[model samples]
Target chain A: MLSCKEAAALVSESLDRKLPLGQRIALRMHLLFCRFCRRFSRQVLFLRGTADRVRGEKEGEEPPVSDSLSAEAKEKIEQALKTHSESKSKP
Target chain B: MSIIDPSKGKGETLNPENWGKDYADYLFRYALVRLRDRQGAEDVVQETFLAALKGKDQFKGLSSERTWLVGILKHKMMDYFRKPSRELPVSGLITSEDPPEEFFDLNGKWQVKPSSWGDSPMDALEKKEFWKTFEACMSVLPGRLAQIFALREFEGLKNEEICNLFNVSTTNLNVMLFRSRMRLARCLETNWFGKKAKGE
Candidate 1:
């Protein structure tokens, strides 16, 4: 029987890649009996979905984008662009 | 006022000067979400613009300028993560330490069981405040783990690609991803789901 630790690792691994048939059955059996591992699996999946949404994967929903470049950083980037543009336009 | 007819391109013109004013925030947010560092995000955005400027003549108007610029931004992010110096040293711990111990015991059993987050946990995704907590939880992860997690969850890179990118065996990569998901799940429960359960 896969222990909860082994079960949890499989739970996470399943998200990244397809587990082999034998390990898949073992994880499924453990998840069937282990409510905690089941919840862990769901929450791990949820974390991915939530992250995708926040990264603007889902359309029509406004992501809660809280950060922005500071004024100094913006100015610096603008200056760099200006200098490059002028140098290119010259010789 | 420009070499090309800026107004003739359906407002998707390649005006490098106005790019910082127009797309800087959007591009920075895009990088920040994946990179999760303010300074790093800023640097990538700058690089993206510079590259876009250098390659403006190649713009074929096949896509919106934003989409084209975002394509360049994606490449910039990959290059940023690919740097050898940026790879964290803690990656070695994947071979040296036991990670599941954070939630599991030495007997390979769960030390702290996951609690029921109740039905419709999806509802939290719609709430703006929940994202605040989510970002907080994401930030709680160690840098390398978070980067790997972001690459998987946010960028949707396949496991094999990430393994090659990080130069880790699949086993080690899985362990790092497991640790990240476990910590994020635990943190969200403590900060968001657990709080909501108590009617907070």
Candidate 2:
């Protein structure tokens, strides 16, 4: 018999697809009889999808092209490229 | 829209410039899932690609190119989560002193019976708004608890790994994890599950 507390912890893991096989079955049976467990499971799935949507929206917004990288990073890239090209030409 | 990897010498071009939309789309979604913030996640993803381009030598192919990019994204997220306020203290999680094993029985029965719900479980969670509300709730958690929950739950890292990553003792980890789960459950209960007590 699982307690409400323990059952709740498994709910998130189950949705994430990480629960063990036996525990998965146990959870399924438990949810069959438990309203709270069922609600929690639904909520977790809902949360994953919603977060995904907001995530998509974020990536769609971007900083200007040239301004994206820092002055230091730009210099480092040039240095790496120069050294790599130079190294390839070594006899 | 170009995804250029200047350090990329002689391999298939993952240059976002050529596959800019696809690359950016993929990286953006990956970071967004973890950060739950659109602009912040995008910034991290962009930084990740730039960093990857610079340190292309660091990759030895233990994982796929995508996974490698995600690994870099994780480090970026670490910085985002490590706020100065995270230096604040957290109160105790459990005064009950119950062992984790107590949550599970030798015969594998739940300590508390689960309550039956209306129709299908999917029906309850089918709405996008439910998740929006849930994410909103999670974003407000105390910084330390949030880290512990994300690492252990989403990343699926082991207890030992979490200890090493966060430098906390096992007892401390247990308390933190227990607290994280409880607070998250409470949040979900309020935001998505409605305040109605079970079987009331």
lDDT (Cα, 0-100) at B173 in candidate 1: 85
Candidate 1's residue-wise lDDT over B16-80, tens digit each?
87999988988898788778778889999999999998999888765667889889999999998
| lDDT of all predictions | 0.84, 0.55
What is the per-residue lDDT of model 2 for residues B38-134, given as tens digits with 9 covering 90 to 100? 6666667666766776677766554446666667878887776564443435342332254444444655444433333335534544465655555
Model 2: chain B TM-score relative to the native chain B: 0.58
**DockQ, each predicted model:** 0.69, 0.10
Show model 2 residue runs off by greater than 4 Å: A1-91, B1-12, B18-47, B57-67, B75-119, B123-126, B195-200
lDDT of 2: 0.55
For model 1 chain A, where is the 10-residue window of minimal lDDT?
A54-63
